[model samples]
Target: MNVSVSRNSSHSEPRSLLAGVLAVLVHLIFVAMLIFGLNWKDHPPEGMVVDIWTELPQPTREPVKTVPSKQEPKPVQEPVKPKTEPPKPEPPQSELPPEPVKSEPPKPAAPQKAVTTPPVKKPDIALKQKPEPIKEEKPDLQEQKKKEQEKVKEQEKLKELEKQKELEKKKELEKQKELEKKKALEKQKELEKQKELDKQKELEKQKELQKQKEKEQAIQRQREQEAKAQREAEAQRAAQQAAARNLVTNEVSKYKALILAKIRSRIVMPPDLPGNPVAEFNVTLLPGGDILDVRLSKSSGHAAFDSAVERAIFLSKPLPLPPDPALFGEFRNLNIKVHYRE
Candidate 1:
């Protein structure tokens, strides 16, 4: 028993050691995972950089108009001043060419400040440049207006396209929702159908099991009934056989009494007999109750009484017997005992 215990301990030690090692490894792995997760979560989120343009520098066409606006009024020629006088005050600085050309609509106040200053007159050389600059500025302003109108149309078109895309996305989402709903309904219906079939099968299975149980019970009951009936019949037959045996025993006793009485009557007692002596004989008889043979089974000590009893037995040739042929076997061989003195 000790050796078996030691062997069991030896076998279990490695398994226990392996389990302990695995537990330690799992703990280490869990700790590592925790460390990694903590380090990953602790880091700060990166910043997003955006560059905002405060002013768009239009240096090509806008420089010409802006420079002229600042310098042209400084050199207002005396002859051209009167001719351009009506047009100068009439043009509001808010509707300036720089607004359309440079795309700086919010800086309209800056241009109004510049344009509000009184014209500074220089020499006659600046007079000739004034009319030419005014002619060029007129055509540039018209072209700028047309470009601004085209930009507005492009913005409207982009907005309409974005709206159409949003509507299409909505439609697609609705369609997907409808499809998902349909699939869910179909799946639910299929599950219901499968459940119903399972229920039916279960019901059928229960029915079959019930039927089988009833059938087994019926078979068992039939077997028990048959066994019971067989037992009853056997008991009845045994009772009948016992009664017949008792009747035969009673009939045989009755015939034995009659034989003993006849033998007692025939015996002649001897006067010289001292005491009563019992004499036993084995007698063989024919079916007619006639003595076939007689043998002394026991002697009475008195010789005269024994002789007289034997002679008397021979005289009574035909003895009484049962009338039933079936009872003749009982009287075929008889044992008779007689006593003298009565």
Candidate 2:
């Protein structure tokens, strides 16, 4: 039960604190609203009237002194009333003037009480006091009017000052708003510029990639053209080489036939040559196709036919050769075969 009570109290404490905070907030909001909503100049404040009384009237002393002085004059006049029985009615009328005489009576009453005060002196002094109060009251009223006017002028000056301050505050707030707007516009412009720069960079990258691709394609085409040119040149060179070799072989064969025909034409056959026996010869020649040396490598099995072939070759001194000097190597050494025909 104690714990539950404590919990309840704690909860109540927080709720009270929250309520207090809300109340304070509400009060602050109300004050702020009043500050903004109320106009100072519309309701002019009342002018303060300050009384600066230089001299205060002795009304208390006047009342006290006048009462006793008027009563004392009555006692003195009552005795005089019997002394002057013929002027008894005049004495009561004389007492009426003493009421205003109280202004100066207090100053001379103690010394002049036994010496009967003059009747003419009381009426003159009383008349002078009445005019003096009237004169003092007139100046007091004028001074109060002046003070009120001055206070009003001061209030107007304060109101003007407050108005000027409010105008300045409004101008400052407008300037701040304009500055904030300028800053926001500049930030937005910067963001747009950044976006443009990013776009330009992307375009440049794409262009660079395109250029690289074009260069690669051009390079591949050039390489293909170069390879085709190389292959054609190789085929033409092989064909030319083969044609040159065949031409050299044909020239060599023609020269060999000429040489053998010349030698055979010069041969002198022996009589009764038996059944066409064959003979072979080994010959060495010079660059000019001159027979340098000749040897019989095979006999015809007839000594006379072999002797005839050997003699025929020596008689044919320089053998026939190809016109081209490059073909001389083929005729540098020669092997010849002959047949003896009857």
Model 1: per-residue lDDT, tens digit, 37-121?
A: 7897586766756667433323332544565455445433332355445434324422453433234333543443343321222
Lowest summed-lDDT stretch of 10 residues in model 2?
A: 111-120
Q: On a 0 to 100 scale, what is the lDDT of residue 28 in model 1?
A: 99
lDDT of 2 by residue, 77-161 (tens): 4644444453444344345534433443455444333232332354356446544665577776645654564466456545655
Model 2 CA deviation exceeding 4 Å by range: 1-186
Candidate 2 global TM-score: 0.47
The most accurate candidate by TM-score is 2
**Clashes (N, CA, C under 3 Å) per candidate:** 0, 0
TM-score, one value per model: 0.40, 0.47
